[model samples]
Target: MRVLRKRMDKPAHLGGVLRDALKASSLDVDLDLYRLWEQWTDLVGPVIAQNARPAAIKGKLLLVNVSSAPWMQQLQYLKSEMMEKLNSALEREAVKDIRFKIGPIE
Candidate 1:
């Protein structure tokens, strides 16, 4: 006697599968961080945004580039507040800390 076997269906689009994989591996957080960089101006005020640029995200720490040493120093002082604002805006603890560096903003 022969037995019948059931077959699994495949996703219509690869996009969904890839997105699911990314979420499963927690890579979606990195994408969210990229989005945060794009919306930096809106998240922080124009003044601070103009002087600073979100360079990268490593784990829970965010690296920011400031146009001048003064701005970098200022940002160092405001790091905690910035983290609070960013995490609150994201509705998650995406950013636990921020590091400010004196570099080219653009």
Candidate 2:
């Protein structure tokens, strides 16, 4: 009983303890989206930068802000392809659809 009590008092490994705590939280979906947000610019860069941002309502969706009507038309034409590329890069079909809107005057 003395030995067991002494062992229980040992300090926990910080890394492992933290991992276990995070796992217990069970917020994987939220975490995944956060990670994707951090990597958005790097992952899609020019393709999406200044064009889109992720928005969560009923489900995951991308809100695209286009510079002009022509650009909007171009993006509208490639909506499905863009969704495929984004979801593929994230390794999960997180984005269910894309919503395009005209950007505010610059």
Candidate 3:
């Protein structure tokens, strides 16, 4: 007589598997940070998205490029709110603070 081996009956979702791998590598936060560029318009509003865009990430700080000085100044007031929205979007606290600079939005 022989014993049968146990095995998973179903396969894991590709997305879920990739996410798990990234998490294990500690790159999940970086992925979320980079996602901001594409999801900026959805995370924030179209108006704000038009004026500013996520540029880079340095540790927990997010760097954003604003179209103009006024826009940069305006973003200062919304930094905390944006950070909250970003963290919410990523489903984790990936961003601790936001820094804005006057630069091309395109």
Against the correct fold, how does model 2 do in TM-score?
A: 0.52
Clashes of 2: 0
Tens-digit lDDT track of model 3 for 1-106: 9999889799889999987898787586578666887798999999998999888787788888999998888889988899999988888888998899988887
Report lDDT (Cα) of residue 99, candidate 1. 87
Cα lDDT listed for each candidate: 0.83, 0.66, 0.86
lDDT of 2 by residue, 1-106 (tens): 4455444667789998876886566464556567656676776566655665544322566665666677678777888887787778768786788777777522
| Candidate 1 local lDDT, residue 7 | 75
Model 1, span 54-94: residue lDDT tens: 88888788888899988988888888888888988777898
Query: Would you list the rank order by lDDT, best first?
Result: 3, 1, 2
Q: What TM-score would each prediction reach against the true structure?
A: 0.73, 0.52, 0.73
Per-residue error at 52 for model 3, in Å?
A: 0.3
Q: What is the lDDT of residue 14 in candidate 2?
A: 93
Q: For each predicted model, how many residue pairs clash, with residues at least 3 apart or on different chains?
A: 0, 0, 0
Candidate 3, superposed: residue stretches over 4 Å from native? 1-30
| Error of model 3, residue 69, in angstroms | 0.8
Model 1 TM-score is: 0.73
